[model samples]
Target: MDLGCNRSGKPKLTATIRRADSIKKGCPFMLKGRFDRVGNFWKLQVVNETHNHEPFVFKEGHAYLRRMFDEEVDMVARLHMGGLKTQRIVSLLCKWFPGACVIDKDIYNLIEKLKKEIIVGDTPMQVHVFEFDLL
Candidate 1:
């Protein structure tokens, strides 16, 4: 789960539960909660508690379960390719997608995946010779 401030300056928390290998293809379990400032406490809520398929063991390195959309990923890759730092990219994303729950690590992972997909080279010297292309 990641915690961040929403557009209205209120704290928001979100979490996503990926489907198991046995489950059918569909949207992952998702939950979004917000803090009630007047109530002076956190208000947790389940956005999608019921799974469309069966449950199984959780897998590792499921970056696709992230809340970011495909277009957002492309934008992040573009920004990173354009020389923006991870921190700066995060700030920009936060501003651009207020309801989105993104973290520095997510952007870092996206950049890594983008690099892996775009810039491929057999030798070390050949690295960085490929042009930027959004996947």
Candidate 2:
């Protein structure tokens, strides 16, 4: 289990109820919970009660995985490629989305993932590549 921060700057916590030792077992049982400031307590909710797919052993870079739309990712990628720092990008995003709040690390992770995708040929960059890539 790992404790983290959510997009809204609230505490985001997750726990693995059951671990899958084999691919035949499918996905591991996991639960995502959050802290409610108003109630001053933690709420444990089962986001995925069952696993239909195999779980990765090495979960590195998985922290950046969230429920974001493709358009949002594209917009963040564009901003990241535009030479905006992670902090500035986060501020802009928060402003554009009043109810939305983002942390620096998440933005950094998103930008890093975008850069890796571009390098690995998984995704194409819309911005021009200068001598020093603004990553």
Alpha-carbon TM-score of each model against the true structure:
0.45, 0.43
Candidate 1 residues 1-135, lDDT tens each?
433211113222344486333222444456677778898887776765555445434422334444689778888978977888889998898788775667788888877787676556446545534532331
TM-score of structure candidate 1: 0.45
Clashing pairs in 2: none
- The lDDT leader among the candidates is 1
Clashes of each: 0, 0
lDDT of each: 0.62, 0.60
Q: What digit string (tens of lDDT, one per residue) describes model 2 on residues 67-133?
A: 3467667878888778788788878877876644467877777777776666664324333453156
Model 2 scores a TM of 0.43
The 10-residue segment of model 1 with minimum total lDDT is: 4-13
